[model samples]
Target: MTGVLAGALGLVVGLVIGTLGGGGGVLAVPALVYALGQDARTATTGSIVIVGIISAAGVLARLRGRTIDWRTGVGFGVVGVPTAWAGSLVNRAVPQPVLLLSFAALTLLIAVLMLVRGSSSARRTDGAGPSPGTPDGGSGVPAAGGGTSGATAVLEAPTRRRATVRRVAKIAGAGSVVGFLTGFLGVGGGFLVVPALTMLMGLSMPAAIGTSLLVLTFNSISSMGARIGHLDLDWAVIGPFAAVAVLGALGGKLVADRMSGAALNRAFAGLLVAVGLFVGVQSLLAL
Candidate 1:
């Protein structure tokens, strides 16, 4: 009965990871603790293992589509490694209730952010004006007045350079935060990664999803490695869970391809809200 339950939960986690490019850890950790009878800390360790493997499988599933931005994903992952280790150290010191409460709060925060972003994107889509950065409002044609003056062109060059620098800095900062969360919570940090990649880095939905999986894979592995000596896994439960999740991930990828990005974002945000509320309520009652 426990084995069957684990498999069912694992499939759900994988589908979320594959379809949304995140949320697996958010689901996995809670399921491990509440359903499978694992302690909070052990559940986190197990979550890292499950999410990391599923993320790798997700990456492979998207490989043929060329939706991933390898350079960005690898750079983000590299920035996160040190912080992930640091977070693991902190994780060991925090009490279980505090950790779970923090996780619940963070999940709620991310859901709010996603909803805000989705609404903003919808507004932009409805507007008639060109996209913010485009000159002719996304018409692919130059403005009717022709090119800018020589002085304007000269100024724009430096502005573009500055923008690039700022973008790189933002990526590094976001990556560090994600890494820390991954280690501290035993989550893949995909809930945060997908938004960061799309909003900050300007990747399209498919690209962001694919790239998020790659980042999750890195964060999960890094966190898991830091917990190596302390980990006490129940392979009997995790083994079948992980195997079923891989198959679910493959199915999720197909579903994502057929859905609109806006719809996916809204759906993902709703799920987060529901889970966050449940987790938060349960934690408060326990306290």
Candidate 2:
């Protein structure tokens, strides 16, 4: 009975992870603990295995689409390794209830981020910005004489240097935060990774999703590896659950091509809010 329940739930979770990435896998923790009768700590460990394997399928589904940006994805993932380990250490010091409340709060935060991202996307599309034909840096005109003067090049060099530094900082900061959450909560961090890749790293939505899956795969490994000896996962349960989810994820990735990302984001945000509210209420009552 438990196996049947777990396999059923894992399929749904994998579909979400394959279709949406990021925060989608966060649902696994709650499902594992509340629906499947796993302990909170064990659930986190299992989430890594499930989400990671499913994300691998998502990555493969995206392979021929040219949706991935390898350099940015790998760089972001590399920065997260140590932080995820640190987050796992922190996780052990916290009580189960408090950890759960923290997870609920994180869910709420992700929902808010989704709405804000949607709004921001709309604004970017309609805002008073440069026309598509505008010159470099959105300047009103092309460079002098259709080329830059040596003096102009010298002047712009420092500006470009500053821009590069800022870009690095943005990437590093986003990766660190996502990495910590990955380790601390055993989630793949796809919710945070998609937006960060799109907004911070200038990837398109499809590209971001693909790249985000790769980064999430790294995060899952980091999180699960940190818990290697600390947690004992039930292979009988995890095996069937992960295998089913892998198939579901592949199917979801196929269907994702026909779906609207905005619609998906809105629907996901609503679900997160509902789940967060329920968890918040339950935790408070228990306390």
Candidate 3:
């Protein structure tokens, strides 16, 4: 009964990850371990399945709205896929306490980024470049230099060679980090994805959110592959959890569209900070 209850709790975890990004999977591991009393390895495997399903649902929702930026998403996806698998392998090797501690700290860090608002951390441009999305940041727009209005346009051509290289490098670097985290932690990489897109790629909030979903999808698949040989592939666990997660993800997408962006960001940041504190305490306690 307790195990079933814990599995039910997994639905809530999936919903949060689907909606917010930072704390969902991070908390899911603990929920599976402590709430359900599963071994860390089993819990980690469970988290991967849950995160993947929720992320795919979110991507589907985003795609329906025509919000996904395929080019940027694919670019990030290419780098993240293999790394996510590697991360899953790492998760198998690491001690549970260490994983929890690292996850907690990451959650807190993302929360801070959420509060800062992507624009504040963005590389300064004197508002000269074309905006990446809607004039108000709601409408998905074309790549700045793509000379088209469609959201699918390739990323804007960098004005300076140095800047272009730097931007590409940043995207690749962020993708790698996000991939590893996803595989290792069973997260969808939303905490890092949104800020990285907004701050580094100059994408608007809507675009970033949409793009992150795609990146998450690719990362999940890659990581799942890593678990294939070592773990039990439990369809029994995946079925109910995925159904609830998909429903919750759909609801979250609606909420995301309705909420005030600034307020949401602030709330998310605070949440991250709280999660981080929890992780730090868990790590210390482990010692």
- Top TM-score model: 1
For 173-204, candidate 3 gives per-residue lDDT tens digits of 98898898888877667777777776678776
The lDDT values for all models are 0.90, 0.80, 0.71
> In candidate 1, what are the lDDT values of residues 125-174, reduced to their tens digit?
79867667786667454444676556566877999999989978988999
Off by over 4 Å in 1: 130-153
In model 3, the worst 10-residue window by lDDT is 150-159
Per-residue lDDT over 37-64 for candidate 2, one digit per residue giving the tens place of the 0 to 100 score:
8877888888888888888788888878
lDDT of model 1 at position 214: 96
The window of 10 residues in a row where model 1 has the poorest summed lDDT is 139-148
Model 3 spans with C-alpha error above 4 angstroms = 2-8, 117-163, 233-238
Better of 1 and 2 by TM-score: 1
Ranking by lDDT: 1, 2, 3
Global Cα RMSD, each model: 2.7, 2.7, 7.0
Q: Which pairs clash in model 3?
A: 108-272, 111-269
User: What are the TM-scores, per candidate, against the unseen true structure?
Assistant: 0.93, 0.90, 0.78
Q: Ranking under TM-score, best-scoring first?
A: 1, 2, 3
RMSD of 2: 2.7
Q: Which model, 1 or 2, shows the larger lDDT?
A: 1
Better of 1 and 3 by lDDT: 1
